[model samples]
Target: MGVFLAIPVSTESFGQKSFTIDFEEGNSFTVDFETSFSEGGECCGPYTIVERFNIDNYSYELIEPSFLPIFSTVYISNPD
Candidate 1:
């Protein structure tokens, strides 16, 4: 004999930004972010400032698997 189970899943949104990332079981990846903004008076000149950063060699280890998996440890290298 076989048995079956049913579960309900729901998601809610409230005008917010969300992000999702996926990685292999035992792999590493790098991520970079760059942003710029300007500050000055509207009538005058607007000075612009830019900044950039990077995340290097990031990896996650899965310890257990369930509704949400637990990570054994998360590894992140130096940033530049």
Candidate 2:
């Protein structure tokens, strides 16, 4: 299943970013990117940064969890 999530981020200062997540019942997963880092990984800091999707909003159409190539903590961002 696929859905859209609206996460608002305010990156005005250190530790100032804040956002909310909503998902459908029984179809959401929560993944903490802070704990699952690979050794010598080139990625660091806010692995889940919020990127604006549309000019009027910052939403993302999440692909179904099973279809993903990698595994991570993902939460349902919408209602079922």
Going through the candidates in the order shown, the clash numbers are 0, 18
Per-residue lDDT tens digits of candidate 2, residues 1-80?
64434543323322223333434443333322111222233564333332222111233333433211223223334432
Off by over 4 Å in 2: 16-28, 31-80
lDDT values of the candidates? 0.35, 0.30
Candidate 1: tens digits of C-alpha lDDT, residues 1-80: 32222222222211222223344555444433333334457785543232333345555443432221122344654343
Candidate 1 local Cα displacement, residue 12, angstroms: 22
Q: Each candidate's root-mean-square deviation in Å?
A: 17.6, 11.6
TM-score of each: 0.22, 0.24
User: CA shift at 51, candidate 2, in angstroms?
Assistant: 14
User: Any idea what lDDT model 2 has?
Assistant: 0.30
